[model samples]
Target: MVDLLKPYLDLRDAEVETDFGIDDPVVYGSRAAIESIFTNLIVNSLRAFAQDYSSGRLESAEVCFRKIIIRTKKLGDRVIITFSDSGPGIREISIDDIWIVGRSTTPKGSGLGLCIVRDTVEDMGGAIRAEAHGELGGAEFTIELPLRN
Candidate 1:
């Protein structure tokens, strides 16, 4: 799945810098669920960044990948995945309302992506959170799932 979405994530010409910290990959969960989670996050990130660029807020005054980082790690008995983007952070006013059903700041209406993310994570006995990217000046999502043995 990552291979298929690699191109879409490429920002520096045709190259993408990815970091996977899972020393030993394990098959502990449904592959379809994992793929869906990543697909939604990545696609949404792309859309948000594009919107920010169109709004003329980027430092370059044009769309450019200053940086985007995807990191994964296995610690003790859990797997953690973090997706960070380098676009304008989520508007302050929409932060609390982002995950609420039918509360979308975008024109599309009925914002439910993050709500679904929360549900899926809970269903999988995992956890997820969204926060400001700090120095990255965007939003970051962290997903943690038990490393089933």
Candidate 2:
């Protein structure tokens, strides 16, 4: 799967960071569905933060920022992965309908990003949630999948 996202990581205008807490992991869970989840979140983050890069704001030494962060860790019997962005805090006002199929707030593509994300996670017997990006100032997605025995 790393082959798919390698190009995105090299974008001169993008800044990404990842941290994994599970080192030399046990075979606790399969990361199959994670690809879709990561793709959707990363695409959204790129779109959201593109403005800063294109507008030349990212080069300013005054403000240091990371456009995206992905992290995974094991907690008890579950594996949690989080994707966060530094765009605009999730449009909570629009979130009521965010997951509805074909509901795209932006005029870009079919607004099925979150919908697909939710479905993929649930199909794996996992759960996902959306929230304010907290200090990151954009959106945060947290997914918790049960560890496969």
Candidate 3:
């Protein structure tokens, strides 16, 4: 995942930290589809940081503090993965709209990113949700997938 997002992370000078709570976490799903879900989430996070930077919410000097964290844990028969960032968190009112097919907070966004993510997750029998103020102080996406036995 880091390799796939290196370009965007480098472009924004963002820091990404990954943690796996378990020795190995396995999920029952298509590899490509699962990759796509995380790809969109990370891209969206980078864009959020960019928006905050341009709007002066993130000062030029503080740009180095921009960060994203991805963590995974296994609970019983499920695997929970979370992706969070240090940017302006989502507003309560905008949370519902985020999953809509044609809604976007970014200017050049197609608005289909999260929609595709949700669809792909559901198709794989997984569930996903968003949090306004995650540990990272920005949007947090939590995905739960069944463990592959």
Q: Best-fitting candidate, measured by TM-score?
A: 3
Q: Indicate the worst ten consecutive residues by lDDT in candidate 2.
A: 23-32
Clashes of each: 0, 0, 0
Off by over 4 Å in 3: none
TM-score order of candidates, best first? 3, 1, 2
Summarize candidate 3's per-residue lDDT along 1-149 as a digit string, tens digits: 67887987888889899997976666777779878998999889888888888887667898777899999998889899999999887863488898987788776777899999999989888999999889989999999988888
Q: Which stretches of candidate 1 lie over 4 Å from their true place?
A: 7-16, 59-62
Tens digits of per-residue lDDT for model 1, 1-149 = 76888777674322234689885456356777787787777666776776676566665544656456778898778889888877676675466677788875455646777777777777788988888554467788888888778
Q: What's the TM-score of each model vs. the native?
A: 0.81, 0.78, 0.93
- What is candidate 2's local distance difference test score? 0.70
TM-score of 3: 0.93
Number of the top lDDT candidate? 3
Candidate 2 structure quality by residue, lDDT tens digits, 44-142: 767656544555646655234646777889999888888887776555346567677777534464768888888888887788887755447778888
Ranking by lDDT: 3, 1, 2
Q: Name the weakest run of 10 consecutive residues (lDDT summed) in model 1.
A: 9-18
Report, for every candidate in turn, its global Cα lDDT versus the true structure: 0.70, 0.70, 0.85
